[model samples]
Target: MARSSTPFSLHRLAVALVSCGLGLHAAAQSANPSDSPPSSTALPGVVVKGASEAPLSVGGFGDTPIAKLPLQASIVSAERMTDRGLISLAGLTSLDASVGDSYNSAGYVSYLKVRGFDLDNRFNYRRDGLPINAEAAISLSNKGSLEVLKGTSGIQAGTSAPGGLVNLVVKRPTLELTSVTLAVSERGTIDTAMDWSRRFSDGHGNDKAFGLRVNVEAAKLRPELRDADGNRWLLSAAGDWRVSRDTLVEAEVELSRQSQPSQPGFSLLGSTLPDAKSIDPRINLNNQSWSQPVVFEGKTASLRVTHQLNADWKLQAHGAIQRLVNDDRLAYPFGCTASDGTYYASSYCPDGTFDQYDFRSENEHRDTDALDLSAQGKLDIGGMRHDLSTGVLFSRFRSRLQGQAYNFAGTGNIWGTLPTVADPSLTGTNTDRTERSTEFYLRDAVQLSERWQGWLGLRHTRLHRESWQVNAAPGAEQPTRYSQSLTTPWLGASYAIDPQLMAYGSWGEGVQSDVAPNRAEYVNKGRALPALRSKQWEFGLKSGSRSVDWSINYFDIRQAAARDVDAGGGLVERVLDGTQHHRGIEAQADLKWTGGGVVASAMKLRARIEGSSDASLNGLKPANVPETTLKLQAHQNAFLTGLELQAGLVYEGKRMVLPDNSVAIPGWTRLDLGAKYEQNVGRQLLIWRVGVDNVTDRRAWRESPYQYGHAYLYPLANRTWRASVEWVL
Candidate 1:
């Protein structure tokens, strides 16, 4: 294990969080009513600011705004989070049409697929442009904003799925402020949080300045699923120092823990799609008396420094580290166990009988490190002006596992009484995995003319990976090692037709490593395969207007694909197949009026297999991706003095369950409604927010994902209601 350069203790963090929360709560209560000033409320996600073109950090297009960049991007501010009552990625991702769930379950860490590709949790998520592990439960209480780059991001992030990049920016210290929130839900869940911040100045100007912000939260989590409940706690702190007029330093640390039993998804009965309406979301197929809640504990810290070299040049250094662990214990229900003790393809018996197992996976550790040094500047080369950004980054990830147990317990009936289970105390298989990469990147923005612009970039990366058997005997088989190097390229051009309209085109290529899963079906399992490459082309038109803003983009992506192949009677081997081609059109439009606004996003995609090793595999659509997705969210200030009304709509087209297209999950649509009210009581500002999800109580199969040659189905959540109260001091 690598030692930490900066010491961090969860004990210290918890103590400090308690102390701060107590002190602030007392101060809020002790404030004299007669001395308090008047209070007022402002609409969330609505702000007035100057007209400045801010760069999309996730795109790595220095000095270029989203309108000028060749790709579409979205930024969700903190205020928007409050207005929408979105607290998890599951909620936030629903606002966009290009994203969908992949093997997501009720209490487990969620997984997502962007543009028809599963986003690698280890490489697709970042914190302030620094790589961080996302396998653990990520807390949003201390995030200032969320940025999503909608297309290929080879120029900024390396070796990632074409699904784009997700970045979390830490919240910084604002003016002196204190706020507390208390919330409850229909399922009897309770949540409370406190946010406190202050800024200190030793001189009038840049002589000396410092700022600090702290956030603490606790929750008793209760989901609609029966017998699957847990608790959560989080603590985070951020600080910044203005050393001089041209230089600044920022740092942040956070710790969070969650304990919730993971819910098992329903499955098909031997290639037969089950009626979603007949399945209840509250059913506890995995609820055994011996089951224990899954627990996840995570800690992360980051530091950044920025310096101004001159009027048009700047330098920056950033470093981030994350450590995470998960303990899983559950009575997992998987494939049906036949009378002969052989597992079958059916998730449940034809008569509704299923076998349960003491599925256990514990003592897993995942650690990550990311460091970068970059420079950005504007210069005149020959006759044309250019904006350039160059950077070098190093990323490393390590994982260690203690063992697992998948021993069968007993057979149970889905509708009848469930059988009791016991722990088998099976031995575990210990393993370790590590990956390291170093990359050098450079990007240039060239001014072709006043109305035309061009962008070019290239990145070179070298990666090394190793997998080990921790308990291998002496002179056993050697550990697996692999290395590769590649160069990725990006090109883009844009033409401004008018102040509010622009046309743009871009192309990029990226590479990703593939490793076959370690399973009993594959002959050559647990081995690394050749690196796969992918390319994308996109064209779009965007409009920026005061009353209306919109964009429409057409994109085509081609990627190398791989899948498990039946080698012979009972064994299988993973083979590198031909290619997967996806052609799609996506659009986003925003409309604003007096006291109301509407944001709409939609996508139409057609994904198919182009060339494959097996002749039968050609022309088949990939499983689990929706061909059509639409989302709409709107809010209006009601005629009532302090009330606002909100609505959301989601529609998804039918998705195939198997590559052969034999079974297809039916299409589904859902509706949501919400309202908020603000009022002043005495001298304090108070706000109340309430909302209901799945208002129609639609019982639908949200997604169907295939793994280990077995099909699994996940269902949508039941209709739920939540309400929260906020007090600002």
Candidate 2:
């Protein structure tokens, strides 16, 4: 099935591109440039010097400068990503204090946590401002920048996790050609990539006729975990055409595949949490022979069109399709200890043998399609200028899960000798699920006064879901359908104190549909619950200049909690009753100088600090989330020409390991260093880059307690080195 889908996808992509090209050509030949109205697209102006100095797109309302907007946002540029060797979402967690890893490991899916809440893969991930489900590894080679909007973003994304929204900006065609990079890491990993862009013109030298960009990358790596290895491949293409002076069309396609052997992280021994200070970071508990490799294949395609109807109005339309397949096999161990500190897998045994060792395997396939159409313009009402936007969005997603679990006979002790068990056959497989949603939204930003701007927005969303599983008995009850609707609103205002400073406040809400677990232990299993809602209030001050940028903000958010209710006779029902609240203060600063007096010819500094608490739990810090987090980085040009030095530090305060706050994990800090050199040779440029992470080789636990009732510990990687060279032709 997988083999056949690839070719069909490619064929569809070809057809779409050809059709768009023909349509564009026809329109360009018939339309006159002089008769077309002025463009009204509200795109942000690009700043090539650095990402921190640039403005970013703010969803359907178009782009706005960071300091001028009434929100907290951040951008990580391609140059910064390359300089720091940040190849995955996992690396971003260390560089940004506001983001953290939830359940991240090599050869598996990546999950992230923001502001003490989980960022859902189904609704919070985007590519080029369009939703694309990313439940597998994501390649960053073709991305121009990574932009993050913190806090409730329901106004921008109809339905999303309240934690935040992440957007990946795709690279576009440029006049200059870049060098090909060849890189290697200390863990026996090799990477190679090539990037090229070109602009095509007509015989009369009209440059805006067409443009194309292509990027390809391949990598093989031996993970830090023993006996684990993986490989990745990616190819991406983007094209743009000027249909007419007032109209434009763009298309993009990306194909990615990855495979790796499994190496699961460690879980706590029953209800007793072990002292994390005593564990070795390199230990692997699974049987090497029983573990299976995980494989992922994904393809995505998108098309966008924009046209100016008049001098004050512009219309835009976008459509995207994504498909992904994940195949995984794993051997997992579950055990607990007695009061005497004796370990048992199934029950407390005198011999300290593991009671339950299971082999689990699953295959999942997902398909998603999304479309968005919107019109935005400037209007004057009551002598006040207003930026108005209205949009409609439609999204459909389908997923099929086939999984089986087999319980083995053997057991192993957590503190004693480990035993190997044979692999078992599969037990059962079931279930297919589908979700669909449609939303309509309207927004307006009005200049209420000379120094005050007010913003108002609202979204009406309708969600529908369905799922089915084979029942064992004919009379058994099953839930196969669910539907819900919500209307979320946004209100905000910003007061400009001066040209370089602004004070802003906002009130917003987010909504998410709940998915039921397909487990037999629950009496109301597969019963869909009502949509969850979260509300947030924020106030902030922002100041920016050519050489410096700073922001400070305070926020409070509350969300309804979902938990299982014990019915009777070993059955449970899901319910939502309690509330969870998160309150925090965040501050960030960025400074850059060129040819300064007391510094090198080029110098840059970036820092962020945050403190948060769970207001619903008597100000206690949430599990797996630190109360205080800090990140600092610096870069400077060395005395030698074309030489640059870079360094960074990350510190995380102690955090609770359980909901009851019975145990805690110690705080830890890490340091990183790197250097890069670029030299021009005639018509070609050569560059060399080297970096080392965890320079002190410190061993610490990076994460704990991603799942309830289970305290899992994820250890940090040891000192690692990376080197790369690039040659431009």
Candidate 3:
């Protein structure tokens, strides 16, 4: 069973650090000149790998060591991704205790919750600081790193979910290299990819140079669920031109497509919870023999220009554009009904019977474009030194739906025969939504005294949205529009009591765009609600050394929560009547030896609804939010001379399924194992890797979420294995 995990002693350790000598700053600044940040004109990697550990740096935050900053963040390097086969967000959940699956399904866009709140797909994702729709799976083959900023720092993103921000750093051209990989899964999945990169010098003593990097991949995926197969392919290229020693230009383009039939999860058996152990994880609950797959097509491109304004300052401008199209087709299983065709309020009936719908939504387009301009460098006035970064961003997002169809097919049983129904007519031009926003941000890292440093940032944003139900208002006079503005501020302070240990605390606020459910039971269904505001504050202590690095964090996050309630009539309306408060403490430690490394993390969270109108819901834990989680990732080199061993453990605590705390799901633990072998033949290097997921074959529900007014129980995948061969050419 799953039990909540915590590190209660962390507070005592923090107190000791404060009372003793370590209060504000952890990692010592790099002394080697080579460890300095890359020139703004040069498009180099984020981290410098050497004998000693180097802190991460990116465009938005300048060259500061993120670990020493007051904010919370995590980095997944490209090497780790390739070694661990972490191509999707689902794989990341096993290593990060605070990340959770939030109604995410196969063959569709990934959804996640950080801490205890859901992330918005439209605003919570970024491509090198510019925004992009995470509505499609980003191909990791062309990515250099993934950065998760754990709070809505207005300096990073103008407006976004309070949960977190996910940034994808695409691969940039580098030294000459070529690699090819072929991978396969035990369940008949196959994948192949090729990566090539090289720099073409001007040959005039390196006055100018052009670098190019290309990635291509294809996959035939066989999912764990029956009839839920998929196929995917991607082609991406990134280039950089060092125009001069003080100027550089970079560009990237990505085109990809994925098609897979989504598998719907199981639901409660009508007022009774089914034993998760009794159900087979591979059963087909939402598929028929003949069905089309949910298709996703994406194209994205970006360009950036950077110049050194002077010896003390740098300026950069970046622009990006993206378009995503989805064709959703499914024979989805839904609510249950009596044998005599009587309607029920929930999913499955007592006898395991439920209704099915042939849902088809096609030609859904999401388009986004953004431009960013910033200057960051050292500044001095009178007798104070400041690391100041100022920027402005303009962005627009548009969503259009061209066709949709949702009609009842017939009755079906989980353990019996399923009915087949004819296709329904498709409607046209159903929805059109556009969002435009502009933001100006400023951040100043001040050197206050020798031991005390502070970071103060602010962002002012103006947003306008227009939504139209074209079907309901054909040839109408105008679309419903709303305009709003918000100014968010961020503050942080760090005291470097010593070089190895630092104490830091930060407070920030963010905004989220919430929408009422599209269900017909409510009066204001399918309407946009007002902007929701969220607040978060945390304090932490961290220490870094040659052999080890560790941090302990405590956070309190509060957000306005939406709920469905009876509005006196028979129908229910969605309302924001309460607040969701989450308080948690997390600890992480990383140790690296000569031939091995280990990462261990744990989170203890108490998330509940407060000040609710419904007495039953007050102080109740929200659905799908786990109380505790534990994760460990480890790798050992030289296990047998040129062989490496890898392992991971994930433990999730018990979680509630209903808002009223009427039902709950047990917690579970899973282990993963893998190995890698490397060999050098003549002039080429070859690597072989094999891994097994869910090695224990535990049968348990991974998540129980109430989405769109319905309950879904997503089961954990059974034991599966994968093997791959990589050749460095």
User: Candidate 2: what lDDT?
Assistant: 0.74
RMSD in Å for candidate 3, one decimal? Answer: 5.4
Ten-residue stretch with the least lDDT total in model 1:
3-12
- Candidate 3 off by > 4 Å: 1-59, 340-342, 415-417, 427-429, 473-478, 515-530, 570-574
What is the C-alpha lDDT profile of model 3 across 1-729, one tens digit per residue? 333333345456446644432321222234323456668786653442431144444325576766577877777888778777776766668778888888877766788888978888888888888899887766788888887777565556766878788888899998989999999985789999999999896787783399999999999989677777889999999999998889999999999999888878788888777887888888766666556788989999999999998998999999999999988888777887787777655557777878887788888899999999989899887677899989889999999886567777777777536766746567433668899999999989898878888889898898887776655535642356767788888898999867666779989888776566544577877667776778888998776665566677888888887777887668878888888888887777776666888888778888877888886677788889998899998999964788999999999998888777788899999999999999888999999999998998999999998876577788888998889999998
Cα lDDT of model 1 overall?
Answer: 0.79
- In the range 1-729, model 2's lDDT, one tens digit per residue, is 222323224334434533443343334333533345667774554454433346767544576677778888888888778888988876778767777778787677778877767799989988888888878788899999888888898888878888898888999887867669999996789999999988888556677588899999999976566656779999999999887889989999999998887555565554455555566655555544666667889999999999999999999999999999887665555555455777544222433334445665566789999999999999999999999989898999998776456566365554425655665555555567788989999999899999999988999998898987632245443547878888999999999876666779999999877765767887767777777898998877776654556666667778777767678998877877556677666666675556220111110111111122323344344578776677778888889899888888888876677666667778798899998898899999888999999999888878875563455667777788999998887
Off by over 4 Å in 2: 1-53, 270-278, 336-362, 412-419, 422-424, 470-477, 595-621
TM for every model, in the order presented, reads: 0.90, 0.86, 0.91
What is the C-alpha local distance difference test score of each model?
0.79, 0.74, 0.79
Better of 1 and 3 by TM-score: 3
TM value for model 1: 0.90
Superposition error at 309 for model 3 (Å): 0.9
Look at candidate 2 and give me any clashing residue pairs.
Answer: 345-355, 346-355, 354-411, 354-412
Estimate, for each residue in 1-729, the C-alpha lDDT of model 1 and write its tens digit: 453322233234334533443343344334523235655653344444311134677788765666667887777777677667666666655788888887876667767777777777888888888888778777777788787776666777778887777888888888887989998986898989899999887586643389999999999988788887888899999999988889999999999998988877777775567788888877867677788888889999989999999999999999999999988778877778766665666467665667778878787899999899999999898778899999999999999886577787887655536866777474555668899999999999998888898989999988998886654455442467788887889998999876656778999987788677655577786778887778999877766544555677777889888877888979988878899887777777776667888888887787888788787877778889988899999989998877889998999888988778888998899998999888888887788989998999999999988766667788888898989998988
Error of 3 at 672 (Å): 0.2
